[model samples]
Target: MGAAITRAQIVEVADRLFYEQGFEATSFADIAAAVRLSRGNFYYHFRTKDDLLGAVIALRLANTEAMLDGWEGATPDPVERIRSFVRILIMNRARIMLYGCPVGTLCDELSKLRHVAKDDAAKLFMLFRRWLSLQFAALGREADADALALHALMRSQGIATLATAFQDEGFIQREVEDLLAWVEAQRPHQDRPTSETRPQP
Candidate 1:
């Protein structure tokens, strides 16, 4: 008998193939072939390609939320938090470049799929943006935080797009590092205390 395959295993394999080859280009046969399964077995897991795509998107979103959870009870300083977030992005550059940031990529590609799907994607992006906004608000720089997060998101997507076009990892890495530096500079000096400490009353 063959090894038992789980739903998650199917989604994991499909996600990689979809990102590398693209949704329109990756067929059910290709996905099944990657998993060493029959096309009918694939159908047993996912009724249709669209259905599979939706599952993949959900999986990606869950993974992101999991990452966010790890930062719970993290530093209250917004600047530091934001910097840490950017570092996380830098560390995951490869996955970001390949999958194109799940929320951003899905919004771009699956907007026309269904009203519910589009709505879900929009909500997910908004939630992440709002979390960034709250972090900036904590630093009393809500306005700048909003602008910075938007810019960072755009720059991140731009890097992923460039990766696809130029096939250059160095270019993407440099761009991301530059963006992080720019963000750090934008932070207020008051947010960073000097070595000299004032005596408390």
Candidate 2:
């Protein structure tokens, strides 16, 4: 194979290792072995672990942006589009159960390590945050758009963490139901006359 393909394969393997075993826990040898590349050859593609990490983060950001863009093109309705965002948990329930939310897990691991790339890794979440905020704003509550986006993001993270901890498929189902209900109730014509408690994730 050409060097470009080899390099891409190394990054792909490294991304999976970083997600499955964590960036701190995964070593260069592990990635090199998984990619079936010699240490010297790996060095030819990436001089340091940070180089691999930068590629992995870039891959993640590209993939996330593509997914969000696909969702936008899939439907024109903002509510259903936002609902599509909320429903990702149900769609990826099995992976979330096994590994927790990928973005959340990466952020937590990087934060704990005090890794300089932590902020860079966090751009994945920002893509989702901005996409959801735009959807909510299009739904006519621009004032609360960011807050709503964060709320949904937090709820998904909590459910993924608990689902991984408890291995509870039923809990995932229940939480998804409540999340859809919450989304369904956020109609543009709805009126709020009094202080209402926010729903728990």
Candidate 3:
């Protein structure tokens, strides 16, 4: 494989390991072994675990931006777009149940360790917060857009954390449905569309 491809593979594996095993618990050798690279070769791609972590955070930020963009492009309705964000709990339920939100868990771990990249990891949540705030603003709640956005983010993190602790699939489903309903209800009464006029995401 080319050097760039090798580096991408290393970052990809490290991202998964960091999410599943955690940042502090996963060592450089563990990631190198998973990527089938020699320690020497791995060091060529990432001299230290922190270097690998920076790459992983970058990858996550890029991927999240792309996802939010896709949702934005998929629908013109802000309510439907916001629904896409809330529905992620249902979409990624299994993994969330297994390991918790990737961004939340990573930020929590890095915070506990006082890792320099804790703020970097938090940018992932910030990314979502900003995106959600825009969606709320588009729906006409400009004054409280950021607060509403943070509320949504807080709810998602809470649901994910509890789901992982309880390992309750039904609880996830129920909470997601309630969250979806809450998102839909946020649409201004004047802006709400009839069932026949509603846009499908």
Candidate 4:
């Protein structure tokens, strides 16, 4: 593969390994082996795990921005936009059950380790928070948009942590339903999507 392709493969593999095994537990050798690259080759791209961690965070940030943009483009209704955020729990329930929230888990782990990239990793949550806040603001909740955004973000993290601990798909589904209900409650009654209009779970 070309150098750019090889570098992208390394970052992608490292991101998965970091999410699945964790930043501290996963080592250079693990990532190099996963990408089938020698130590010298891996070092050519990343001399330290921290460098790789930064790349991984950058990758996530870009991916998340694209996702948020997609949601914004998918609908003009802010309520439905918020619903799109909530439904991610249902859509990624299986992965959440296995690994917890990738962003949450990585942030928590990095925090515990006092890793320098902890704040950088947390930018992922900040991205979601800002996006959700905008959706809330669009829904006429500008006065407490950030607060409402944090509420949804906090609940999703709590659900993901518990889902991973309990390994219960039903719990995920139930919590997702509750979350969607909460989103609906945030909407002004006059602007609420009707039963026939709301997307099914």
Clashes per model (N, Cα, C within 3 A):
0, 0, 0, 0
Model 3, 48-128: lDDT tens digits are 889989999999999999999999999999989999998999999999999999999999999999999999999999999
Summarize candidate 2's per-residue lDDT along 31-78 as a digit string, tens digits: 999988899998999999988899999999999999888999998788
Instruction: Look at candidate 3 and tell me the lDDT of residue 7.
Output: 99
The pairs that clash in candidate 1 are: none
- The number of clashing residue pairs in model 3 is 0
lDDT of 4 by residue, 1-201 (tens): 899999999999999999999889999999999999999999999988899999999999999999999999999998889899888888898888888899999999999999999999999999999999999999999999999999999999999999999999999889989898888878776776576354433
Candidates' C-alpha lDDT: 0.69, 0.87, 0.92, 0.91
Winner by TM-score between candidate 3 and candidate 2: 3
Error of 1 at 57 (Å): 0.9
Q: Write down the lDDT that model 3 would get.
A: 0.92
Better of 1 and 4 by TM-score: 4
TM-score of every prediction relative to native: 0.76, 0.92, 0.95, 0.95
Candidate 2: which stretches are off by over 4 Å? 190-201
| Per-residue lDDT of model 1, residues 1-201, tens digit only | 433446778889888887766666789898888888887777877888878878877877787677665664676666666666667556767776666655566676666554356666576676667666767667677667787677766776677767656766788778767766665655566654565243321
Off by over 4 Å in 3: 195-201
